[model samples]
Structures are given as C-alpha cells and as structure tokens.
Target: MMLLLTQQAYADDWGCQVMLCMSNPAGPMAVAECVPPMQRLYDAMSRKGFQWPTCDLAGKPDTPKPFKLDARPQVPGNLAPQTTGQ
Candidate 1:
C-alpha cells in the first residue's frame, strides 16, 4: 500500500499585508483578515489529502464575517450620475 499526500498554499490580499509585518512570528500564523477565504481554500485542500498547520494569532484574531459580493449596490439616489461627455 502507498500513502499519497498533497499540499496547497494560498495567500489573500489581507494575508499579504500581515506577511509584510516582519515583526510577526516566523511560523505558520493565521491572519484573521484572510481567514474566511483561507478557510474555504483549506477545506478544498483537505479533501485532496493536504494538511494545514494550525496558526496562532498574537492577540485577537482578525477574522471578519463573510460578505456577499453580488449584493445590491448601496449608492444613494441623491447622488447625481456624472456625464462622461460634456
């Protein structure tokens, strides 16, 4: 019998910001800003036999709730549309 394993790496825009902070821990650390999307990616990777090491946040985790991207626009009706052609 043979055991197969896979690895998947993903970094979001927010995660990138955290990585820029050289002061952070040097091991696997989860940045709350990217948790939502990262979780989804992690789940998919797990299904394929990949493993993600646990991450510890120095203080409070920055995980933000997922928001719908396709929801209705919130532009106020009072705002006048700008004309491209004058």
Candidate 2:
C-alpha cells in the first residue's frame, strides 16, 4: 500500500538524519531539537496504521510501553578451514 511505503520512506530518512546528527560532539544536545520533528513524523506514521487496543496491558488509564531494540551478539564463525579441492 502507498501508506506503508510512505511510512517506510519517512522512517528511513529520519534514521539517516538522526545518525548524521548523532555522529558529532554536539549530538547529545542536538537530540532535544530533533524531538519535535521526530514526534510529528511519528504521529503521522501512527495515523496511517493506528489501532486502538482492546485491553490495557499496563492497567493504567493512558500509559503505553512500546518495544525497543537492544544490542545482541551475531552468530559465531566456523573454526574449520577450507581446502582447495574436496
């Protein structure tokens, strides 16, 4: 769908911008300035695929905890070496 494509494009652009901004000494301070625009982008993206929850997982009236990413290790490399011919 067009909406999904648009969302993906916007996300990619935002990610690039964030990465560029965070690659400097002033990166930490720059985050505050980026928040508003990022928030607006998120709002627009959410509107495209917004869905109301049937039940509150937190049990609170209006609190939601979204998923996040964490660093993880990659698969280990093979120890054996290959020969020229089998």
Candidate 3:
C-alpha cells in the first residue's frame, strides 16, 4: 500500500517535470536534463499506450476542456463590392 502511494507520488513528480520540459520555448531536446524524461514519455506513449501526463504542481486540469467559440463573426460590416480595372 505504502509502495503504491510512493510510486504514484513519483509518477506525479515525473509528469510535472516532463510537462515543464515540454513547455520550454527552446524545446525539450535543448535541455540536457529533459532527454531521459522525454524518452520515457515517448516509450510510455508508444509502447504502454499511456496518455500525456498532466502536472498537478503546474495547476493542470485532469482533462482538457474545449474553448468556447462565438457562433458568428465579431465584425458586423461586409466588404465593399470589388471593381475591375479597365
């Protein structure tokens, strides 16, 4: 029981690290420390069929929510009629 909890905690921490490394503007490969975590992520995703991990530490939601979009365009005016040059 205790070992399970410990493993869960470790996975959470690793997930958080992976999330941060991925979000880096320079990209994951640029970070020397991110290589192993990235490889682990790839292996887990490719072989174990695991979903991308979320970071609770980074305030990530368990499931992604779709953003709401306006049904209509914001601009009210239509474009002027096109004129061809002689």
Per candidate, the number of residue pairs that clash is 0, 0, 0
Candidate achieving the largest TM-score: 3
Model 3, global lDDT = 0.70
lDDT of 2 by residue, 14-35 (tens): 5444444444466433677566
Worst 10 residues of 1 by lDDT: 14-23
Q: How are the candidates ranked when ordered by TM-score, highest leading?
A: 3, 2, 1
Q: Put down candidate 3 lDDT per residue, 1-86, tens digits, no spaces.
A: 35543333365577777876887779985798788888888888887557877766564476565356656535547854444782
Q: Residue 55 error for model 3, in Å? A: 1.5
lDDT of each: 0.47, 0.48, 0.70
Let me know the TM-score candidate 1 reaches against the reference structure: 0.22
Q: Model 2, stretches more than 4 Å misplaced?
A: 1-30, 49-86
Q: Tell me each candidate's TM-score.
A: 0.22, 0.24, 0.51
Ranking by lDDT: 3, 2, 1
